[model samples]
Target chain A: MIETRGLTKTYRGGRPAVDGLDLAVPRGSVFGFLGPNGSGKTTTIRMLMGLIEPTAGTARVLGQPMPGAVRQVLPRVGALIEGPALYGFLSGRDNLRRFDAADPAADPRTRSERVGRALDRVGLAAAAGKKARAYSLGMKQRLGLAAALLQPRELLVLDEPTNGLDPQGMREIRALVRELAADGTTVFLSSHLLDEIEQVCTHAAVMARGRLVTQGPVAGLTAAVLGPGGHGRLAVTTPDPADAVRVLKEHGLTGLRADGDRVTGELPEAPPDGPAPPDPAELNAALVRAGVRVRAFGTQRPSLEDAFVRLTGEGFDVAG
Target chain B: MLRADLLRSEIATTFRRWRTLVLLAVLAGVPVLVGVAVRIQTGRHAGGGGGPAFLAGIAGNGLFLVFTALAVTLPVFLPMAVGVVAGDALAGEAHTGTLRYLLVAPAGRTRLLCAKLVTVVAFCLAGTLVVALSALATGALLFPLGKVTLLSGTSISFGEGLLRALAIAGVVALSLLGVAALGLFVSTLTDSGVAAMATTVGLVLTAQILDGIPQLQAIQPYLFPHYWLSFADLLRDPVYLDGILRNLGLQALYAAVFGSAAWARFTTRDITA
Candidate 1:
């Protein structure tokens, strides 16, 4: 539901914060925008939300040009940019009511009912009467989520939605996102947590240093990390690591390393001129034939974490 | 319909703050203090003509207390109160990060700005009424009520004097719109609410000081506070409209100029906060 073309924002006397970004978020997909801190994810989101105009380029949300069409488009889009910003003096319920009042399209007659539902959805209904200043960081984060869910939206753009939450709170937010997505609402979730993306996202985009490294379905990203053979490293635990290594090398497993009782090697790609790489079961039979006491044999599939690190050339906070 | 709701929300939020209440309390206190002080001074001396312009008349007619209180507070306390509210309107929202949510609510930038200005203007009226009403009540309790004397030395009924008092309170409130608009303009220039408030109040004080200087008389007519005290001319026999109209016109000019400036800056500027 969101698209950008050559979206670039260069602050005065500084490098472009978001340089030549072209993002396409589909209508019914949970799109994960993964990047490290200061990687322009928030900048891109801000531009998309029309909070800040792009120095050069254009952004469209729900098929209408941004900033220019903000009034027409934004009412249908819910956003929690950066974090939950609230009036500390106002109660959580009042905060929701105020934000609800801002939307011209929101029905005033049902505002209280909708605000209550949003608060309950975020598990903040009990604390709705309390001033927001007294809320914990996790509660504030949830209240921010509550504001975004105040109405049934066509698109929900959340930046770091799970930040400052306990493990339980994080799980709850993830579940909420899943529930929202299941209802056919497109969710644009941005985070540095690789695990969050892996757990919840259907489609994913990897960004590094203000540029898109790669993007596609989560399965495609993980599968693409492996070569054309779609094979990963072959790991074997044996009494005679030397014998197992010899057997694996004979089977054409490259980058063999033997340490203690374990021998790990890269399973080579299918050879065009020769033959296919031996399967893990075939390699195990070969190790057994070599008289190596095999304790364990498995192929380690690459994870999204490994894919993100490789794609971005930077480590991500893999912990949810 | 939505604009009305937004405006109601803005007005409710602005008046509900303890800071706003305290500012009103302080403004309301000024009239009581002045009325009590005048009562004491006249009681001790047994006559008038010792205090400020309107204070000396409070002993004969309690209604003069409203006039005295507005005169006393108009130059500083009233505008300072307006400055605080107006200056914090947008910047406070930005500092609290609520501005983004409000905007994203699709509260159109122009619509939100209009709501904020309306709320600030409401404060101007409310603040002035608080001082006037407080002074009227305190005046009734402290001094004798009788036929009212105009500044031109003509006698008018007490009801007419009361009507004139309400008119003066209104004029005093209108006198503050220039400062209100200026404060709102300053608010759009910063994210720090405190900084915006301080700058607005400082600008008002500086303009007052400049208006006071004889050397600056050439440009004094252009200053926002130049015609502030023209409300006193309302007490004249025919109720002089020259200075009152000029003050209102000057305030309208400032409101138009700075209000548009605020709109320009707010609509075009990036809301990073």
Candidate 2:
């Protein structure tokens, strides 16, 4: 678990990279940190990892103040920040061995075994002997992942684990994240890819301009955007647009718009504890009774992206 | 145990590199090349030709080659080599993006800096030994070994002479500790390994240059390399401790001053790379 109280960092002569923001990451949840480029996600992660000192405020990672307790806390927290920071001249196995040797608790006698196991887990066993500089981007990323998994960590904090990966590599990383979480390790990952987070995260937080826009369980976030009906849009295709609009208005729909052969109307807001929206069957029956030829009626439930856009405003880096 | 493991890793990663091997080989090769050149020259001319102080003394005792090699490499080659290794210790890792990973090892910045310093000092010892050993071997093949005469008109046994050579090599390595510490401090200031390396070597060159100018004599005593060659006094009969001690004290001062500076800079750094 990690918590922060107004954890802020301001570089010299510049704006704060991370403003006075509060954050809470509970244990055993695959928490997704969502944001755009330069949204201060990496800065916040660095502060928690004790890579950088916060200019103001403090962070408690694993229940201890950061940096002061980093030596004890970090070993139990596996992380792949930015990308795989691999030594180009060293073979993948050598890099892992070097990092493993740094951990005082790691048994040197079993270092080889641990290194090999880590490589195997990341699917880099075949290329384990090659110099890291010779590896492809995806291979290097996986090697970074392997370094993070040199031991069984209590938590995994991965920063954009699939930044430059192809579709297949992204899928592999996503699967690996799910597998780790399934094994009971809390995963706190920061990513610009909304779909990736939606696919794997149980809880998510959105950051914009160094502020937390919103954060909660994934289902709850999506449900928040579409009212209680859990659907974002409803559209009716009809030749008799006049009758369709009048009938839909009579049904107490608001924000109605009409075009040639089509009429769209916004349903009433369903309070969190309120009853569900009226069934489409009743709407169809009402339209039929009003002498309107309903060609088609379509409804779309809001996606994680749509909810995210509403939370962080437009132009979030959905693919980055 | 943690320190040893970290030290083992530092040494392993350092010595395994092709660049490090190349630097060592070049260091070890210098004595051989110098020995051969002196041998061919002496064979053609009847010991009338003069070279470096140790090369000139080789006709009397080949063991002086160790002294000569240490002396010859002290000014430029050795410090340049030490500068490269020390400068690259931290900055190279930063350049390659491995510094962050090393820190994530929770290798506390202080511990990591100390580990890097130990590795560089180890290189200084190893580099000096290679030159001394190669020179000793080449000198034995080229000249005779016997009771060595001291600089102050006294003689000592060959065994004592070997012991003195080892001591001299050690002193010579200690002479570069200042440079190593200084290089590490510069490394902490920059993420570019090349920039750090160039800056360190440039500082050494500038110090040596300043030490030469008569106008800079007032400041020369404070420079790290000012008394580098003072190890020559160890060959004196009474074992001139004044200059040697001063040289060592100056090195210690540089190490203490620059070592703390490096630690401060490194520990507070943001590690943006």
Candidate 3:
């Protein structure tokens, strides 16, 4: 678990990388951090990891103040920041062996085995013997992931883990994240890829220019902005548009638009007794009562991208 | 343990380069070359004659010039080598984006710096030994082994001469430590290896120039490179050990201060790379 109360970090002569912001990451859940480029996602992660002291306020990882308490929490945390930091001269096996020193309980053979398994998981098993300098960019990214996965710490913080990956690699990484979370590891990852987080994260936090826009369970997020009746994108093919319009008007809905065969309308604030917006049951019953044939009446949920745009505005990296 | 891993990784990475191999070869091979050159020069001076007179003549000249060259070169070149190696210890990691991985480990910044400093110190001592051994072999082959004369015009026994040579080597190592510490300090400020190397060499050249100018004598002692070769005084009959000790002590102080400064700066650095 991690928490920050009004944490702020300002670089000299530059905009504050992380502004006054509060954050909370619950234990045992995959918490995705979403933000745009230069949006202080990495800075907040760094502060949480205790790599840099906050310019103001306080942050705690696992109930310990950052940086000062880093040593205590480090044994229970694994992280991959920016890019993989490795000695290019050493082979991938050696690189793992080096970081394996952090885990004292694991012996050399056990460590190697763990490292080996991690490399295999990341699809870098074949390149384990090669010097890191010889690896390709995707290979380096995989190696970084392998290093992060070498041990199951209580918390895993990864920044942009899928930045340079191809579709296949991204799929592999997403599956790995799900697997880790399923095994009960709390993953706190920051990324600019909204779909990746939407596909895998159970919870997420949105940041903009170092400020936390909103954060909560993904389901909560969907309900809050996506609106009731499942963020209506209904593809209703009604036989009587005039009758449907009259019925919706009677319900106090407005902004109805018709294009060819489809009619779209924005639901007004839900009535006190109503079950959220665009209730499929209510609409179907109303149409049936009106003697109108309803071909399609499925609920429409906004894509995570649409939600992100709604939350952070256009031209921002909201997947962070 | 993480520190050891970092140190091992650093030593391994540094020694793997062709440049390191070439440097080691040069350290080993240069003495023999100097020995052959000394022998040929002695032969020319004697016009095909060889004896104690020729040997003593060559020995006297080689001890001063060749040994002096080694002393000056150790501080000048060896420290630069140490600079290149130590300077890259942290910055290169930052440059290649591997510093974050290292920092995120359980090891603290102090521990990381300790590992890097220990490795740099080892390299500095090893490099000094390389030069000393090379020069000693050359001195033995090109000239006779016997009592040696100091720059101050006093003579000392062969045993004493060898001891002095080792002492000088030790002093050379100590002197380079100062530069290495300074280099490491500079490394914390920048991520570019080339910039680090250039800055280190540039500082050394400036210090040497300051040391040479007569007007800067008052402030020269404060500069790290000023008394670099004062180890030569160890060979004096009366043995002016005071200056050598002072130089070594000054170098130690600089190492401590600069090294601590490097640690102070590094622990607080925002490693975005």
Interface Cα RMSD, each model:
0.8, 1.2, 3.1
Give model 1's TM-score versus the native structure: 0.97
| Model 1 per-residue lDDT tens digits across residues B107-160 | 999999999999999999999999999999999999989789999999999999
Q: Sorted by TM-score, highest first, which candidate order results? A: 1, 2, 3
Fnat per model, in the order shown = 0.78, 0.69, 0.50
What is candidate 1's lDDT per residue for A1-320, written digit by digit as tens?
88889999988998787889888888999999998887888888888888899999889999999989999898888889999998888999999999998898899999999999999999998999999999998999999999999889889999999999999999999999999999999999998888899999999998887888788899888878654534577889888998888888888888899989988998888768987667778888878887989999898877788887777766854222
- Number of the predicted model whose DockQ against the real structure is largest: 1
lDDT of 1: 0.91
lDDT of 3 by residue, B194-263 (tens): 7887888888889888889999889988988877767767766787888778888888998989998998
Model 3 per-residue lDDT tens digits across residues A1-320? 89999999998887788888789899889998988887888888888887777899999898898888877787788898886767777899888877766443335557778998999999998989999889887888888888787777789998889878899999999999999999999999888888888899989998877788889998788668656544455445676777776776665556666555566665666769966665657876887798867666664566767777777785563434
Query: What is the number of backbone collisions in each predicted candidate, taken in the order shown?
Result: 0, 0, 7
Scored by TM-score, the top model is 1
Off by over 4 Å in 2: A225-230, A235-250, A255-265, A271-276, A284-297, A317-320
- What are the lDDT scores of the predictions, listed in order? 0.91, 0.88, 0.76
Which of candidates 2 and 3 reaches a greater DockQ?
2
Cα lDDT of model 2 by residue, A1-320, tens digit: 98899989898997888898798889999999998888889999999999899999989988999978988999899999988888788898998999888777678989999999999998999999999889999999999999899889988999999987899989988999999999999999998888899999999998888878878899898887655445555689998998888888877777788989878877767667978666777888989988889899977567888877777776675322
